[model samples]
Target: MGEERECCHHRTKERSEKEYKDMINRLSRIEGQVRGIKGMVEKNAYCPDILIQVAAVTAALNSFNRVLLANHIKTCVTEDIREGREETVDELLATLQKLMK
Candidate 1:
């Protein structure tokens, strides 16, 4: 039997229309880039060319992460701090450490 239950570690955010669209658009572009890489592999493209495309995809992903992290700091982190939720700062630090690694 399949059952749904609330997860203690799971949370959700309500994003603005623009934010939602922006995220989806970015992900779509990344998906397209990955598909292009797959095509390159299938078509026996040059190794260097495929590697370069993979690098581009990595850069795109990092750019997306930067945007998301900035938004999180501006919204979630700021609001949590304002509400005297000091644990949010610790959580932010842990996230930063993970990202750095």
Candidate 2:
């Protein structure tokens, strides 16, 4: 990521470490879920069960995206607004519109 796009919130060493750990933990869980799905496919699991697992992974990904987007808006976008960056607000809105679709 570009330096200019860095999150406005200043991260202490501890917070950085915690965030990294949390992300890694979440990713690992998602990885395990994906592996489970792969195994289910190989074993010819029931279609409904496979669909349920797929839905779960999609929900998990959407939840993760929501958290990241919330953080970005709270820190970066809010800072931009306070610093007289009206254009950034429009840019954010446009980006969100795309995401919603």
Candidate 3:
């Protein structure tokens, strides 16, 4: 994927900093949430409470993905369009669909 873009592109920098940082931050929070969930389980906490935390983690991951996907569309897909590589549009669409599932 990195090979697809030149070294000095704004999209590359934006993606590297903005989207990746957001994802890493969210994943770190989710990791902490998972640890709490494990502690809850170890302490014999209520099942529903543990389930709620699990749902929270899932939602966090989904939110992270949504942000990443939006950035990908605005940057990578837009670049592909500008470069007249229509095939990348299909690839991006397919990837988004897979991520949604």
- Point to the candidate with the largest lDDT: 1
Q: Candidates ranked by TM-score, best first?
A: 1, 2, 3
Candidate 1, residue 64: how far the Cα is off, in Å? 0.4
Q: Write the per-residue lDDT of candidate 1 for residues 3-98, one digit (tens) a residue.
A: 432211225666778988999999999999999999999999999999999999999999999999898888777877777787888988999999
**Which ten residues in a row are the worst by lDDT in model 2?**
6-15
- Residue 87, candidate 3: Cα error in Å is 1.5
Instruction: Determine the C-alpha RMSD for candidate 3 after optimal superposition of all C-alphas.
Output: 4.7
Best by TM-score: 1
lDDT of model 1 at residue 36? Answer: 100
Query: Clashing residue pairs, candidate 3?
Result: none
- Residue-level lDDT of model 3, residues 1-101, one tens digit each, is 45645222343444456546767888899899999999999999999999999999999888877876777777777877887878877887798788867
Clashing pairs in model 2?
none
Per-residue lDDT of candidate 2, residues 1-101 (tens digit): 54434455343122256656876787788889999999999999999999999998888888877877786777677877888877768877897998898
**Ranked candidates (lDDT, high to low):** 1, 3, 2
> What are the TM-scores, per candidate, against the unseen true structure?
0.88, 0.76, 0.76
